[model samples]
Target: MSAMNAPLDLPLHAATLNPFIAQAWRERITPALVDYIAIPAKSPMFDADWQAHGLIDRVVRDAATWVESRKVPGLTLEVLRLESRTPVLFFEVEATQSVPTGAQAPTILIYGHLDKQPEFSGWRADLGPWTPKIDAGKLYGRGGADDGYAIYAAVSAIEAVKAQGALHPRIVGLIETCEESGSFDLPIYLEALRPRLGEVSLVVCLDSGAGNYDQLWLTTSLRGNVTGTLKVEVLTEGVHSGDGSGLVPSSFRVLRQVLDRLEDARSGHLLPGAFHCEIPVERIDQAKVAAQALGESVWKNYPWACGADGGLTLPVSDDPVELLLNRTWRPTLSITGVDGIPPLAQAGNVLRPFTAFKLSLRLPPLIEGHEAAVKLKTLLEDNAPYNARVTFEPDGRVGAWGASGWNAPTLAPWLERAMDAASRQHFGAPLGYIGQGGTIPLMNLLQQGFPQAQMMVCGVLGPKSNAHGPNEFLHLDYAERLTASVAQVIAAHP
Candidate 1:
């Protein structure tokens, strides 16, 4: 039978989420959501002079006003301040009626970042990243899918559940500004607001995604991040290549030699001691399922060069499980930037005095960030050929995170059921569980602070959403369904 004609044996309590919340989401939430996403709250990473550029403040105020207007009977909203001039907006929506003396309702903490990656000006017709637009049933905007819409979706879901006289969990939305820059200031904000946050039972992070809109992706693992600056000094100043070629060792050559020790060019395996970790069996199963869903088209979806001379070779593992495991459960390294080099223009042949590079290392779940940083520095220093003076400066780092509760038997099945219901009603497929390589440090932090909380990371950015790129967008239909799914989960929580 076709999905549209299929019967839905939804949970009795979750039925309220179907026609009522879904229709309300499409009518009341979608249009205003597009306008909310148009604001350009570019992260501090892209805009160093963020304070001077007051767009972030404007966006924060906008969010505060929206939340204040929708204030539930017992909920209160607060705009918080963090160190380094960072701003965080917190929404504390309490249960209207109290539980019995010993019985407590499960509190779900929803997390999202309001800031956006920079948007450079070039886009297809009627489709700019900052100018929100809806086309072919897709909501196109910079922060729409990545996170701005998440705040609205979370609150709307709670409202929908409450409006139906169903059981509504106490929800707190912790929205921050510096997530794109590795959440440098979040620790301070969390500490300052500890009392208000209280104890959380579940964390619903709407900041990750799947390979596509065809299925739901629950991120079970995250790769750690280690970024540092590697500097090599060969001479006090630049000298003519003809005079310095043989006499002085080139810093660039020395740096390249040091990098060669880290990864194998053919196999892409990190050298021994680069990282160590274990992959769980369930994640392996999830990867296999993801591969089956992707088919051979997975490789083609990746951004790759067209020709052999200038293109990346395909990964050796044809099985989707191996591919996904490698991405989420293993450590990898990339040279992100190079410094102390003159442009090709106005060039004379000269041997540079020094060269430096920005190196980024993705850590496995078992590795510690500071420990990895120390090992990386020692390796770089020891491997430098010809005793070339080298120094390593740590930039920023976030440790890897694996889900704390794989078998939250109650929560997992409920999410799966809710997502499945939404998919059948909208797209007609079972939701997919997956893992992401990127780091979301807040998930780990929240889990640590509230050890009992069942954390679930899900979101709307699908394949080719192009977040952090020129033409970023959020899929409209998927987003609407996602909102309804959230409502279903809130309603179904026992």
Candidate 2:
């Protein structure tokens, strides 16, 4: 967005790019994506019997079939399955433009995933997670924007480039179905397919969020995640509350006390020093810029409940920049799921034996996820309140922990110029940079493997296009322009 950013090269068929992508989404991708949304292909964590359901397999096969049917020039698609892991769809588009003599063409690795989060509660009367509907030009459904649209957009971008007979390099797409579950299965496939995944100079990950739908936003960093269940037990069996009132300690109260060690209940700040990291100066500056680009909408966009007195409810801070830093650069804790609680209607005056809560801790980008998980387990499980039995069990391999976060390498000058050029060409605005609070395990993996690769991490999860929550929708107009923007970047790739 700066005055020095590279000016756009005459767009290779710029006049027709949007029309081509728009038609592609309307006639080809949307219908298929609709079917994709309807499948309820929840991630493995949500559906333990995913294999028996066969939904993952069906969606993979369908996506593979659609790609093959595209018949793009020099394109070959494969649905790769590792004995027990979820499937990944890998496709390649050979270089089209003549490469300079003595220079190997650079490879562009476009990454996304087909897996989706579980169908959470609180859907609108007309909308459901699996029911795809088009209202007001947005496609309402889960997974459609979160990532099911990635492969479709990736191929369509290639097609747009080829349709113009534009100069383009080798491009490969890696769409896995386990991303929502921390991408636990991806490392294996990355190793097995390492040889095939050529010198990847660029990674176009279309699974992050945008500051807004008005302009292009690049994710500069992502927070890591550590999730596990913490349970506290004080009694072997349930007893009437009146009878056990004074004798037995409350499991819920004891569990809360243990969690107090990890987080400040009132302020919501994670207490451990290991969970915090130094916020890079560049990221702080970018957050300020992004905060300006998107003002109060940064936090006000969230659906917070009204206060008891009918006044507005507030976030941790009202400062836009601080809120941005808090979500992206700082660590926080959330209780996602719970057990050992009775429904209000079924509430018996009984003392429960145990209380378990699913804890999801978001860590700063530099903190190691597994190490944090280990530390969290120790912090909570060590000191027993009233000597109550408290245990912390984490998800993922014991040593590996959950997903570690990623901070992208320094932006390459060429890629920065290309991105700004693409943004100007498509959205009539400069490109924006923001750090996303969500974790993308694959980004860290790819950065570790290709340390020099410039990451183009952008997506359609802008404003209220909630990916995991109900009423999720994909802004069709923005997506169409974004598709064209991606094509522009690829055409500008050196």
Candidate 3:
């Protein structure tokens, strides 16, 4: 039935939705989410044998089974597989009634990922990567928050809205399994399914972060990424450190010099005229608002441990606004992993022949990942100190994204009211907006395809959620409220 013809008395306020969504999650969604988290559906990057392991396939089946059990009216579910590519779970909840040919009923697209990051070390012993544990309202495991709850949340919202006797626009769910691998297969699947994806008016993405668990956080922009291995080779073989100390240049030192070309050693600032773009005035204003709302939590929320035994403490800028800007709008470099180094116990007093460092660079929203990767490779390879052998091999380049021409006059007011109601009712706080210091490569593709649509990115990854790291978790109460917020927006979509 057309939403235009739905009954006007349907309850969409917090009084009705809060309890309804909460009950749905308690009775239906939570159990399934826990089960989903137990499956080790590691992304292709981490598990090159994902296809052979069948973990991705198992996740697709799991989501399909849960969605089917919900028995959402007019729902059609399918796992779309392109040859040799990761699966895309495509499901649609149809509108109840038909309208005139010239009329337009908004089609809202929901995007999320079922794949997960590798199990980083340091998980609390009680919480294993694939072991599901619920303690004090937090679901602890991999993928639960970094976004395993997304498909369940999306379907639950539709069911809750319909149960309230209100109708939503046509809702389409696109859950992919290659997101953690930089979504390389997404563009292919998207192009193949372009014809079926109708005129989209809004896009809801539940794959971002919140400042805290107290209120809903909307992502205004997402940083981009370039990942690769930087290697420096100085000698054909290792020699005693005492013999080579005077004649040989340490590969580790050469690596440091090459990295200095990209970022300053003292300030950690990216070199000028490298991979940077001017920050828009609007983003700066949004950063101020987010900083005010987040306060000290902006820095304190991180799980930083003070160095024990006369070690250093975390050093962050005192100004939260500058910290937020540096995180979301500026470039940063981190050496995630290193090779060719022996453990302390096994190390001999020898100069290493080669050193390989895994480089993970986060770029501003407007910088292109491919361009950044090229520039970095050139910078490292062109001027090798002592003409040593240097090779920069990029593993992947994931582009950054922002909401371009992101005016959503109709959906904006509804979202504001919905978030306000949901936040106050659930957390006794108000909703806030901020830019995330991460990348969701799929969003750039969706924005490029549906430039005219309103895109709202929000999720359950809040402070201490530790997504992409050890001790990852999903705040159960927050996920429940976020589902209701989604339901409210769906019911109110124009």
Candidate of highest TM-score: 2
RMSD of model 3 against the true structure: 4.2
Candidate 2 wrong stretches, greater than 4 Å:
1-5, 97-104
Ranking by lDDT: 2, 3, 1
Which regions of candidate 1 fall more than 4 Å away from where they truly are?
1-38, 71-73, 102-105, 120-129, 309-317, 397-426
Question: What does candidate 3's lDDT look like per residue over 1-494, in tens digits?
Answer: 22223233324866877788888889888888889889999999899998999999999998999899889888999999899899999998897566679986678999999999998899997998899999999999999998888999999899888887886778888999988878888888889988778888889999998988878787888888888899999999999999998799999999999998888988888995766778888778878988888898888877767688655456558899999989888888899999989999999999999999999888888877777777788888997999999998887534421111121222355555655555555676766778888888877778788877887789988888999899999999989878987887787776
lDDT on C-alpha atoms for all candidate structures: 0.73, 0.91, 0.83
Query: Candidate 1: minimum summed lDDT over ten consecutive residues — where?
Result: 401-410
Error of 3 at 212 (Å): 1.4
The lowest-lDDT stretch of 10 consecutive residues in candidate 2 is 1-10
Q: Supply candidate 1's per-residue lDDT for 56.
A: 84
Q: What residue pairs are clashing in model 1?
A: none
Residue range 59-167, candidate 1, lDDT tens digits: 8888788767776565778888754566998888776557878875667788998888877555677788778887777778888788887777888777777777776
Residue lDDT tens for model 2, 172-272: 99999999988899999999999899889999999999998888888999999999999999999999999998899999999989988988998998788
The TM-score values for the models, in the order shown, are 0.87, 0.98, 0.93
> Per-residue lDDT for 281 in model 1?
77
